[model samples]
Target chain A: MEEIKEIMKSHTLGNPVRLGIMIYLFPRRRAPFSHIQKALDLTPGNLDSHIKVLEKHGFVRTYKVIADRPRTMVEITDYGMEETRKFLSHLKTVIDAIHF
Target chain B: MEEIKEIMKSHTLGNPVRLGIMIYLFPRRRAPFSHIQKALDLTPGNLDSHIKVLEKHGFVRTYKVIADRPRTMVEITDYGMEETRKFLSHLKTVIDAIHF
Candidate 1:
């Protein structure tokens, strides 16, 4: 329960949007901003704000990539990956502890 | 993500202590106040406050049971059981969606 409380209070993943962004980026490592916005069904402005929060927490980095056109990309930092992993593992522990 | 957000915003289980209380009572259905306090490592006053919130939400009912002595026992209502089950199921979905 203490662990769950701590996880819930996490600065980076406390909000649902940020948590969704992190979960989406955890496996892929990096993704285009547009792709994330589409996948999460968030507007550009909303995603940007949440991404800023994640960046401020050192959980993610955003930069522009030049391909056919200039596009924004969001990538999870190593620290972010580790923290997300720990959160998920602790959550699994809590879930498993419940017998029924 | 929406489901996760809804669960996080739940009035009864939003707080960690109340969530812990629900999880602890889900299986047992009913438990003594002292046992809950001991199990969750919460102060008597702290547990009382959380229990009051749960009761107000119609999640639990507290009453005195006179066995050897009068002891306050907390029991989960059917509504609480249903809501807790839904919360756990939604959480499981979110966890399963993460394929890292």
Candidate 2:
């Protein structure tokens, strides 16, 4: 019955912040930390910690912008997008299973 | 901002199986393993592993029934209910933040 690996729970995108980040990035492809912070209404510290975990997991990678003032930019890696999609698909299956 | 506890992500119901279990048990209060297995369409092995994790985390408790044929039963702990509620509430806020 279990076709996929049984470690979907271990994905770092399991957190709401990370989930929100993935949803936000899904459209834009990339965005600055401040933009995400504002869009998600997350504190700088809270958002930073969550993104740090994603970066550590290689689900997301970050870089410093080269402008008048340097800003941190973040984006979901191809692997991250793939994993996030899988996770969401898994969740949808669970919900659907319960419904009918 | 971070008003509630910051460890919401650490809660074990973050898993889809566990989340599905909690949602299934929320109104029923308890259920047979086979019932949940069929309802969620999970492989017995898959559901067992996820339930083991939840039991280990004290989110759920299990026992054997002394019926015509022995069977396993499972239910969410009070702490699990509380924590699951918090997790859902947190997710709602994150999604709401993105919407407005």
The best candidate by DockQ is 1
Model 2 DockQ vs. reference:
0.17
Candidate 2: tens digits of C-alpha lDDT, residues A48-89: 998999988888899998899999999889988787666656
- Backbone clash pairs for candidate 2 read none
Report lDDT (CA) for all predictions.
0.81, 0.70
In the range B71-93, model 2's lDDT, one tens digit per residue, is: 99998889877776666555444
Model 1 segments more than 4 A misplaced:
A8-11, B1-21, B28-75, B97-100
Query: Which residue pairs clash in candidate 1?
Result: none
Candidate 1 chain B: 10-residue stretch with minimal lDDT: B7-16
Tens digit of lDDT per residue, candidate 1, span B1-86? 57655654565665556777888899899999999998778789989998999999899999999999999999999999998888
Per-prediction TM-score: 0.68, 0.60
TM-score of chain A of 2: 0.84
Which 10 residues in a row give candidate 2 chain A its minimum summed lDDT?
A1-10
Give the poorly placed runs of model 2, Cα more than 4 Å off. Answer: A1-17, A23-29, A33-64, A68-72, A75-100, B1-8
